[model samples]
Target: MKRIFIILSLILVSAAAVSLNSCKARDKNVIRIGLNAPITGDIPKVGEGAKFAAQLWLEDIKKAGGIEVGGKKYPVELIIEDNETKAESAVKASTKLITQDDVMIIIGPFASKQAVPAGGVANNYKTPMVAPWSTNPDTTKNRPYVFRACFLDPFQGPVVANFIKDEFKFKKAAVLFDVASDYPKGLAEFFKLAWEKNNGPGSVVAYESFTTNDKDFSSQLTKIIKSGAQILFVPQYYNEVALIVKQAKELGWKGTIAGSDSWGSAETVKLCGSDCFGKFFSTHYAAAGAKGDTKEFIERYNKKYGYVPDDVSALTWDSLNITKKAIESTGGLTGDIKKDRTAVRDALAKIKKFKGITGEMTYTDSGDPQKCAVIVKINNKGEFEFYKSVCP
Candidate 1:
């Protein structure tokens, strides 16, 4: 009886050891990255763009036989969590990705509203996170572990303000933005400051505001038209762009309508139609006449998705590649999630220059890129065409 009991105990111990070894092997063989996106709420298109871009990147990774790090290749797995376009959900997603999913890095919650809060969670957990489309300064401000793939609103705001002043020689401007949203509200303020600085105080004739989900802008339009503003700047998402532009025109406003990077989505023209044509906006890239890698990416994405991929998609692609470069630059992972996260974060901070499909980026310790912004015009055919380049 003692011999039988001894044999059973040995068998159980060996089985336990095998299971433990298998778990360790699994962890070492695959790299997990988290994607926190608004897949279902106000901006599903943004999430779709992000997801499609990541998938295309994964296909390239597979073709290369996985990502090579320290002379060895490891497969990558993306754990996508929908933030539902809410700040609370974004925080929850970040927490889950870091604590439960054990993701080595995180990407997205692209909007500043979500990215800002999610960034705090990722920073607290010491995980590296990159926001590809967020332009708000707070998204990466003082967060060592958080970085962004796009320029900050402080830069973008002035770019647009100066563009309007130079292009149209306009002295008076009007601003209409979503007061409840972080990206628009923050960007609107920056633009207002820049405009006023150049044209003196009170140059922004009609600084109007609206909350999110407020479709009717007739009251704001009436005020703007009466304000004698030369141009109206609406720093809003694609969905709201169409409504604002169409409504402004319907109200007999003759002034030009301009926008910010939020107008980079393909849906902007699709939804706005003729109302958006001949309008200019500041964006990350221009797809109508792109060359080299940018052209190739646009072609591939359009062929697969049946529409030109927007700046969001292009930025997301670049961000994923940047993440991959950071991972490989680490030489190898130590199989410890915490140690690996720190290594990747350090590697990312050290990347001096990265040529992305959108543009070239030079990183500093602040985690924001020093790059130029593109001024894009919606041509007669509803295509986003490159108008001018503004550098800081």
Candidate 2:
């Protein structure tokens, strides 16, 4: 009887041990990441690129058996929400990610205007958000939980303006911007200020604004052509910028066209065809002939997705990697959600001189990266070719 009782106790002990092990495995082997972006709409290509790159990263992590968090490996699962290029939709999607999906970290809503509202939702839930390409300062301004891997518009605008003045040696310029986008409008104003500061007053011959959905830019292009401006600056996204360039070419506007990072996309060349050739723009990174980590990412991305990565892809990859670094540095999400989020936020705020596939990312007090900007010009082949780098 005594021997039988001892054997029964051992069986119970073994069962309890197995149950505890299973619970630990479950706790240590899964991480949920939220991806919120405009996957459909006028500028769906950009969001698609970002989503594709992020999915590729997660796939790679899975193939490698996932990431090591707090001495345990966990597979990453990406939960995607399409914002449809609407701010209200972005907010709703973000709320779903926060409340329904319960993602601790979010990446997304590529446009600055969309990011503004989506970021607000993350802030309300104390979830850390890393924006891949929203350059408007207000996206991260006064939002401690919000962080961006890309440089703010103020920094990039001046960089492009200075490059135009010093590198291209342009004195008289014209401005064409999207009035509806905070990214373009804010960047245009900053570029104008930088142009005047570098050159003399009244250097910009013409300043024009257009709505985001406007396709026919013949009127604005005609005005710019008549202004006798040597260079034209269009601070807008790839879709509209491509259309504007095509229309501008049709209008016989031969001035050099310049724009912000929003012009970085594969569809830009496809949409504008030969019209976009030789147009210059400021961007974060490029995949063609990229070296070091950039080259590695390009190779892996091509192998994984069967296509070359773009600026948006590189930025999204960097954003996710940065978030992983922050979480790893914080020793994993084991504490209270609020406290863990604060720790991750603090870790991200202290990121300095971290080399990323895009460039070296150094976070400021506002959680914007102070990094190098690349000047890329569309070659005659309609491909973005590297020109020069500007460090900030």
List TM-scores for all candidates, in order.
Answer: 0.94, 0.90
lDDT of each: 0.93, 0.84
Query: Compared with the true structure, what per-residue lDDT tens digits does model 2 show for residues 1-392?
Result: 99999999999999999998676443324677899988998689878888888887887788878777688776778899999988999899999887776676899878888998888888878888999999988888889989998888888878888888887798899999988878889999999888888888999889999887888888888998999998999988777887888788888887788988988888788877888888889999865568998988888877877777789899999999998888788777674555766787888888777889998888866668888899998899777888889887
Best by lDDT: 1
Off by over 4 Å in 2: 1-29
Tens-digit lDDT string for candidate 1 (1-392): 99999999999999999998777454667899999988999989999999998989989998898889999999999999999999999999999988878899999889999999999999999999999999999989899999999999999999999998888899999999999999999999999999999999999999999999999999999999999999999999999999999999999999888999999988888898999998989999999889999999999998998989989999999899889999999999888889999999999988877999989987887779888899999999999999999999
Candidate 2 local Cα displacement, residue 133, angstroms: 0.3
In Å, residue 266's CA in model 2 sits off its true spot by 0.4
Off by over 4 Å in 1: 1-26
- Lowest summed lDDT over 10 consecutive residues: which window, candidate 2? 21-30
Q: What TM-score does structure 2 among the candidates reach?
A: 0.90
Clashing pairs in 2: none
